[model samples]
Target: WAYPMQPIQSAAMSGIGYSPIGPVEGTWVVGFFRDGENAQDPVMLGTIGGIPQNFPGSDGFNDPNQVYPLSNLNFHGLGEPDTNRLARTIGTDILGRDSKEHPVVTQKLSTTPLFDESTGTPIPYPGVPIESEGGDIRRIPKALAEGNFWVEPPTDAPFTP
Candidate 1:
């Protein structure tokens, strides 16, 4: 789920659950993963998007204010069974982030595997290089493996256009 990290554009946009930290819009953000002492490899979950919803206003506006979904939301990651190391890592990485900044949500499955299609298993971990269609290729990190991550939206999440 390697998403493009972008820079915040304004003072009004400089808080938790805000937009990303770069110039690209809605780039794929990645959540790293590991197995025991070894970094298992990261997974390509999905892109982050904004969602809009209504909220009650305290200033006596009478009508609820239109707010982004992630503005007041908090997300918790679910750990898979039978793995103590996995549980610990999940707790530290996913739960450790500020809910206002990094909201948690379910990770979506990718249609394409990060490894070579001819081989069902992953390509070489940590150092194997991958070539893409647009002449862009590089060695992927070991933190990106199958089945080890999730994503969540913000409370005041905006509508991604």
Candidate 2:
């Protein structure tokens, strides 16, 4: 049996509160065996992440139920990492995004925002922080522009709210 490690954030109590999930299929983990020479009891330390270039195989060590790296023509965020780009500290500033990265973050926020055809929600845009001084997002931004930025249906979409 494989023994998995948990982060300090996990309470590790009676199977409740903040537990690190065990690695799923296709996840690359690094670890060692507790039994040393026995090499039977593997201890999974952590998972390795990267841009998944290839799809999972049919046999082993891969996702069995679904195909991965879905066709770019069929899906968005194909080459993106597990964590959203806007959530990563790539450039200096708010929402982990800066004006410096071309075509990645803020640049696309204004110039060309991709919207959801069904919901009209801008898919490419990140949920901007609402606070004035530092953009804290805890409270909603009361005084901001509001309108249908996407398309024009015959009447308002069913999701108008």
Candidate 3:
């Protein structure tokens, strides 16, 4: 079954799992299905570790020093309500630099297909223009699709002097 690409902000754990590059606050049970497989046939994709249980209340986990509950954290289950807030938190945690001082993440298109709601047939997702030549729409065939986790900064892109 082909899964449509959703922006990192709103996509389910499957698409997001392929990238595996952000903060998720709860332990997640991600499920995966083979192409053309029934939704009921999903195989275990394994679990994601959420915020440590012991994290202090100020940081928002149940306890600053214990392992956190695998199901209760909202950010892990639903994501930050505001992308900016998510961006800033991840920016600080992953890069150790201020989100204001550097670009947090770059958006890219994926060739995953969104299935028809009722018939379950694959359908092309609407396209959007991007700064690059072809715009942000991903046009590659899903069988040959590849996911990129790195960004190439321009020669003039800002850097610490």
Over 1-161, each residue of candidate 1 has an lDDT whose tens digit, in order, gives 54343223211111122222221222224445656457777553433322212333455422233321112222211222111211122222222234445534333222243577887676533422321111112333444465443323333444332
The lDDT of each candidate is 0.29, 0.38, 0.33
lDDT of 1: 0.29
Tens digit per residue, CA lDDT, model 3, 1-161? 53343333232321122222332333244567764455666564544432233323554333344433222212232232222222222321212212434533344344468899999999865432112111111222344335522333344444332
Model 1 earns a TM-score of: 0.15
Model 1 lDDT-worst window of ten: 9-18
Encode model 2's per-residue lDDT on 38-109: one tens digit a residue. 999998766544456556668777667664333332122235543322234222332322332321222222
RMSD of each: 18.7, 16.8, 13.8
Cα-based lDDT at residue 108, candidate 2: 28
Give the candidate order by descending TM-score: 2, 3, 1
TM match of model 2 to true structure: 0.36
lDDT for predicted candidate 3 compared with the true structure: 0.33
What candidate 3 gets wrong by more than 4 Å, as runs, is: 1-17, 22-25, 30-45, 48-122, 126-141, 145-161
